[model samples]
Structure formats: structure tokens, C-alpha cells
Target: MTVFGCRSCDATLTVPVSRVALPVHADQKYGNRPGSLAPALEPGTFAVNPLPSGPPWRRWAELEPGEAEALGWYAPRIRISAGPVGQVLLAPGDVRGAVIDPALVSDSACCGIDGGEPNMVCATCGTPVAIRIDDCGLRQAVWLAPLTTHVIGDDLGPHPVLDWADLIDHRPGIPPSEPGGGWHPMWAAAAGAALAHLLATSGGEPIVIPDHQVADVFRPTLDRLAGPGRTGPERTLVLAGPGLPDADGDLALIPQHPQTGELWPVAPPVRPVPLAWDAWRHLAFHRAPKPVGRSVPIPPEAPLALLPGPRFEPDGQIFLSVLARLPEVGQPWLRAIYDRGRPYSYTFHVF
Candidate 1:
């Protein structure tokens, strides 16, 4: 009686049957509400056919001659996206920055958008706005007007799209070394660490100052610490203030390279004072000594390799790269890259 066999062969197989049949209506099958179909479609059909009429004609005669000419030469189109918000626009590669149009701000709460923190309102409108990453993978700068217009609750508004051209000429809050170029990864990282350290140690408030000015005060101090024959680590300098712990007293000044993770001892001549944004500036820029000799006699036709970029560290001490260009002899220039929320840059030179 107990013989092993296939379920079908033993006549023991059972199959469940459904009572519901597939829907025939397009809306029913597609589970779409009425009027949800695209304008190009017909009822009960999934196929899309071209209209008998060609492309819609615009009356060219209505446009001014100058406007028509301008249209013909308009820049190439670029796609920009911020989560659900996106648009395509023609822009020149040289554009400096984008201006967020005020119209895009939504008055009502946009559901499904998540602001990073609770209680944070949208920067554009007063409602709680969600975090939306911009379409361009590159970080962008924010314009105050559009941000304030569409802020929801306390959430910051989206950064504006930048015109690459304009940024090349403008000065950023932290100017990079080259025009339209970013800093070396090591230096950038170091600067970021320095900033983070300032924030963590300073009760969340970090002071920002000009990069060159910070270097002027710190460079001499660093050089003395390295001693003779010891080249300084490639470093990036950042300024933060207000709440940073006392460098000499409450805090310890431990300098390290961002990339190589090399530890450099804090040298004298560069004393760590309390975090004071204005004081740093005054010491770096206002009090910097002028070179005594005639242009430090740059040897004619001598080729010298520039110093590598600064390195960043997770702990926030930027290891500045000491290049062949010496500030003591020649008028060496220093700059910082300003990333305004997004990766935007402008250069400032220190003579």
C-alpha cells in the first residue's frame, strides 16, 4: 500500500483555482486612474503612433530678429536634477554660476522628501522641505535669493547651478590654487579634517578665514619646526574660529599629513594661539614682513618643479606641501578653494 510514486501519477495532486479573470479595460489592467494616460495614447492600446501632422509649428515671425539670432546660437543643453526636481537648459561651459529661478519653490509640503534632521524646515519655503541631491554629480554653489525663496521650515534650499566660466574669474571663500581647478586631493582632505577638528572641538562653530592669510601666520612657524634640511609636509591650511579649544593650553597642536598619514611635530616660531579669526588675519596679512632683497634673485632660465598639493587628515591638521617656491626669497602665491556647499572654486593670491 505504501508505494512511492509521482504526485500526479498517484492522483494526489491538487491545484488551486482563481475566480478572478484578467481585466479588459486599459485603466483596469494598467491600474491607472482616468485621464492618467499620456496625451499621445488612445484608449485600450499600448502602441504609440506618430500624428499625421508634423512637428508643431511656432510662428517665427513673432520673434524679434535679435532674439531669433540669439536662439540660433544658444548654448548646448545640460540636464540638471535634484531628486524629483529636474530640468534641461542650454548653458555655456564658461558659465560662472546658476541662478535658481524663484518660481520652482513649492508652497505646499512636498511629501517623500526627507530633510536630514527633524525640525529642519525648507530653506526656500517655510515648510519642512526634503533633502534633494542635485542632478549634476558635482557639488554646486547656492545663491541666497532662490534658497530663501523656497525654504521649507528650516531646511536649506538647493544650491544653484554654476556657470563654469564665471567661477574661473571670481574669488571663492577658500580659493583654490588654480583657476577653474580643484586642490590636490591630499590638501583638500587635510583642510576638511582641520575644519572638522575645529567644529568638534569648538562646540560646532568653526571660523573661516582667507587661506593665504592663514598660511602667512602659520608658514613661518611651521618652517622653524621642520628645522634645517627637513622639508615640511605638504599641507592645506583652513581657518575656523569662535569656539575652537585653546591650541597652546586646552588643546594640543599635532600636525600630520592627510595622505601619507605622517606625523609632524608642531615647531616653534609658529605658536598656537587661541582660535581668533581676525587675529590670525592680522598676523598673516597685515603684519607679514616684506622681503628685503631685490626679488631674491631668481636664477635666469632655471627650471624648478612646484611643490605638491597639501594633504588632509581625518583629524584636521592640514600638511602643507613646501614647494621649491620659497616665500622668504620670492613673492610666493597661495590660494584656497571655496566650496560653497557644492564644489565651486575661486582663487585668491597672497603676495
Candidate 2:
């Protein structure tokens, strides 16, 4: 348990928190609705993205030569974040003594904040401490400003108890949709990050997921991107984890523990594609009995009842951003995907 306190006033600001890996989709922007996405990190958890993020933007042209390489971007972006590294990201609910100031919000965003500027101020001293972003199309998060806060307690006791087998007994079953049954942004974010990994090691051969529910989300885009294979079935990826039979396929979709961020162990020769815990859990139990409902039919010309979210386009930024960072990205075949690939943007839907 680490307690974060304001550097200026030394006031306690955050609940006891444990460190976890920065999620591959940490910065992902999902459906264009405020509060639509889950908190970037779970409560009682935090992550430090050593990579530079946040404001003080620099256009690609304006940057000095080699600046892009310095910032960990292998491919070009329209604009890049030139802010300081070591920013602390955790759920806003974990914050204890800070209140959001509407006036301090970054104006680049319309509905809520974009998080480049400080929106959270210390209640005791009014020192700018963090920024809260809960906007349409962006993640709902609170980023503790660099150097504004520090950890005062370090007694995080008995953490990382989520062993591979323990998760099944401890965590509740994960349903595919959010609380009222709509496409989950976490799913979109997970798909984006996992697709990058799937493509990176794919040798450009078409990807095949045996899980029918997961296949609906990834297989179509993968088929188009990697191609339908020149020869017969090359390999297949199937959901795999503790208490489940080993997949006979070439690849396994495995869980990265939510608390520790370590991928579940798999036997060698079976490559692993890491999905966040929730995503892995959902796919692992996709066959669990679910309530079935009858649908109300509407004319083809009539509009669907809802238009709350953007159509199912996987988060391209997450796809490319993650692809660019993979150690295997140097491979020529994998380089083409993030460097100059259209497969991520092709119109597709899995919902």
C-alpha cells in the first residue's frame, strides 16, 4: 500500500495503491461518450508510463531530427506528445483529497477534459496536482502531474495474489458487455492491443481464433490484413489459461494478471498473445450459458434504436501505437502494419 501525498502541502491524496504495468491500451480512446470507458487502471492500482505523454505538443515537422526516435515512436504520427515522462495514472476514485476545477480543464476537448492541463487541485493548498479526463472518445482517468505528488507509505501487503489458478476462484465471471449490455470499450482497447501482438508475430499469414465470440471481433480484420493464406491452415490462436485444457493450436491467448501484469505461463512452442485480464476472462468463458433474448425487427430503411457510440472500429491509435513499440516490430513483415497498413481502418464490425 503506497499512499500518495501532495508534494507542496504534504497532504494525503490517494488511497493505498499497488504498482502494475502500464496497460498496452492505457491511452486508448474508445466510444465517443463521456464515462463510456472503464478507468484506465483498477482502483487500488496504479501504473507509471515511463514513456512521455501529455501536453507541450510538437509537430512532426517542428521536431529536431531523431526526436521521433527519441520519443519511442518507430512510425510517424500527425503530432506527438512531448510532455514529461513518469506521469502517474490511476483511477479518479482512488484520489482522496483533490477536487476537480472546471476552469482548469484543457479546452481542446468539448464535452469533458483532454487531460493535458491540470484540473485537480489539492483541497488543502490549492496546488495543481492532477488532471481528470472523462470525455467522449477518451479514457476516463486521473493523471497525477509529474513531480506534484510523492508516495509517503509503502506497505502494500500481500499483493499479486491473483495467481493463474486463483483468479478463477476469486474473480467474478466477466460478461462481454458493459452494465446495461452494450459494446465494451475495454474490449475494443484489448482487441486493438492484442491485434497488434497477433500481427507482429503472424508472419503476415492470416490469423485464426477458435473462440467463436472472439473470432467475431478479430478474425475479419485479421483475415483482410494477413491474407487468407496461400496454403492450407497455417496456425490458429485459441483462448487458454488455468483450469482449461491446453490449446492444440499454434498460439494461445493468455491473461496478463491485472495486479502484476505478468502473462500467464504457457508451454513452449505455443506462442502467447497477451490480452488484459478482463478480455481474457471473457473469451475464456464465452461458452458459459448466457441469457438469450428475442430481437425486435425493424425495417432495413429504419434507423437503429441507438447511435450512442461510434461504429465498431478498433482503436487505430492503440493498434499502431502498440505495434510501434513491440520488440518484434523491427521485423520487416511486422513493420509494414504500423508503418503503413490500412487493415486497421477498414470498415468492420463485430457487435
Candidate 3:
């Protein structure tokens, strides 16, 4: 198990935990309302890396031309992000000697505590240690202050992600809305990232996700982004991932290895169109039950609601990151989407 401590004083700060791949919520906006359920982290696991948009970032405009080129970017229009120093994530229970200063809490979010900032200070040396996020409708976690805490314990080298065969029956599920009553960010993030890949690999053709759920989730944003007129072949987006059906279709949203971000290869081999592990699994399990189940497991208080309630906007950065990696960014259709600046402004309901 890995342990983190104070970098300045070497005082232990985090409980011993195993290293885990970065979570989808690592950069997620938590708490749409005061009483939402804050998602919990897996016990004894930690993500010691900063998520995109996490602290310790410099804007592209802040760098000189040589510095920007040194950072491996030919363009400065996009946000240049790097891992923050001393950042760590773990379950709230794993935190030690950290106290929530009530005064540090935000006035805007009062339903549950919104510790979005570094609200927890180390009781030992008075250093800002972490952020305790346990607000309703969001994931509960302790976001360690970068440059304050230090990690102690054996460093595990990068672990290979679970292969496709192992996840065939391990698909995950996501809620349409947050607990406190707001749209879930995962849908939009997923759709945006998926749209990026779809356009990048579309071969100049219009794409379609036959699955009503997926189409409903993505089509609005994609159509708006793809623009009104484009003459080309039609591509199909199908749920194709590990242990699932063959991706004989034009385009497949394959699952990336949860740990490694490695995409499950299509039979004949194709450019990777991987989704973040969680999102991929959500799509993979959208309709079919896990192969091992006779019926999907229902949460104790599952909401009996109609499908496709409302689509919320995705995290803009995540969407951009997904799209920016593709060469298709220069394409007229893709350029239009990029130009929208705030793609989330478009309102579409999933339910």
C-alpha cells in the first residue's frame, strides 16, 4: 500500500492505499444540490495524479513561444495542463489529522458540504492538506493539496489494465441525473469525447449510433457540431467493446483498459476509438445485462423513471481534450464544433 505524508515535515497524511487508475470523477464537478449523494472512492486505493484542469496548470498564453514549443505544442490556443505536484486522492476515511474549517466552506453550496477547494488543513503543522468533498449529488473524496503532502511507501510501477476478456461481463452503470437533481456530467463528457473520435475517424462521412440510447445521448451535440450540410458516406456508431459483440460496424466505441487506457482491438484491427473505461462500460451495458446476470441488479432505492430524461452539458475541457488529439480538428465540421467555445450551452434532455 502507498502512503502520503507532508512534503515539508514528512508527517504522514494519508492512510496506506493501493494505486488505482485515475477515476472519471477525478475532475468531475460535484454537487448540483445540497443533498446529493457524494460518490465514494474504492477503499484503500488512491490516484496520486492530477486530473485535467486540476491545479498546477499554466494557461497557454502564459508561456513564451520557446517554452510552448518545449512543452510539445505547436499551437497555444488550447489549454496546456500538467500533473500537479504532491496531489493525491483517497477515500475520506483514509485522511488523517485533517480538519474541515467551516469558514473555508463555500457559501454557494450549502446542501451538503462543498469542499471543492482546499478546505482541510493538516492539524499537525497547519499546512493546507486536502479538500474533503462529501457533498450531495457528487463523489465523496479527499483531494490532497499539491505541494503540501508527500507520498510514502513502495511505488508500484504502472500496472497493466485489465484485458477485454475480463470486462466482458463487468460493464458498469451510470445514473441519468445527480442525486440532488441535475444532469449527470458523464453523459455529455462521454458524448463529446465520442464525438471527437467519431469525427476524427469518420473518414468524412456522417456517423450514426443505431442504439436509441446512445443516439439520444449523442446525436444532438453531434448534429449541431457536425453542422447543417455535409455530403459524405454514413458511418455507424455501435457499442463494441471487450467480451461484447464484434465491431463489424463502421465505427465502434471500444473500451479502453481501465488502468492503462489501452483500447480493445477490433478483429481486423482499426484505429483506436476508446472511451474512458467507465463511459465505455456504461455504453456497453446500456441495453444488455451483464452476461452473468439474469436481471440487472437494482439499487435499493432505484428511481422508477422513464428513459432519456434530459441531457446535461459535458465538461468542456474533457470534450476538448478528446477532440484536440485528432487531426480532424482542422476539418470544417470539427472546426465548427470547436468554435462553439461553450458546447454545453446547447440544451438537450436525455430522458
Worst lDDT run of 10 residues, candidate 1, spans: 20-29
- List candidate 3 stretches off by more than 4 Å: 30-32, 35-37, 50-62, 66-86, 101-118, 133-139, 155-163, 175-184, 267-269, 286-306, 311-317, 324-332, 342-351
Instruction: Kindly report the root-mean-square deviation of model 1 from the true structure over all alpha carbons.
Output: 26.4
- State the C-alpha lDDT per candidate: 0.24, 0.73, 0.62
Which ranges of candidate 1 are over 4 A from the true structure?
1-182, 205-212, 215-253, 257-351
RMSD values for the candidates in order, in angstroms, are 26.4, 6.5, 6.9
* lDDT of candidate 1 over 259-340, digit per residue (tens): 1223333334332222212122222223223446866764544322222244311111121111111121121111121111
Q: Which pairs, if any, clash in model 2?
A: 1-155, 1-156
Q: What TM-scores do the predictions have?
A: 0.18, 0.80, 0.71
Tens-digit lDDT track for model 2 on 110-132? 67677677899999999999988
Write the residue-wise lDDT of candidate 3 on 1-351 in tens digits: 577877667778867776765654555543355554434456767776633334456677677657645544333354565545446777888887778887787775555666545787777787777787766655677888776777666665333334566655554656556576766666555555666677778766777766766666667766666655767867777778755767777777776665554567776544456676666666566553334654877653443332345544555555665565455676775666665664233432211
Residue 233 accuracy (lDDT) in model 2: 52
Model 1 has a clash total of 60
Considering lDDT, which of the candidate structures 1 and 2 is the better prediction for this target? 2
Candidate order by TM-score, decreasing, is 2, 3, 1
Worst 10 residues of 3 by lDDT: 342-351
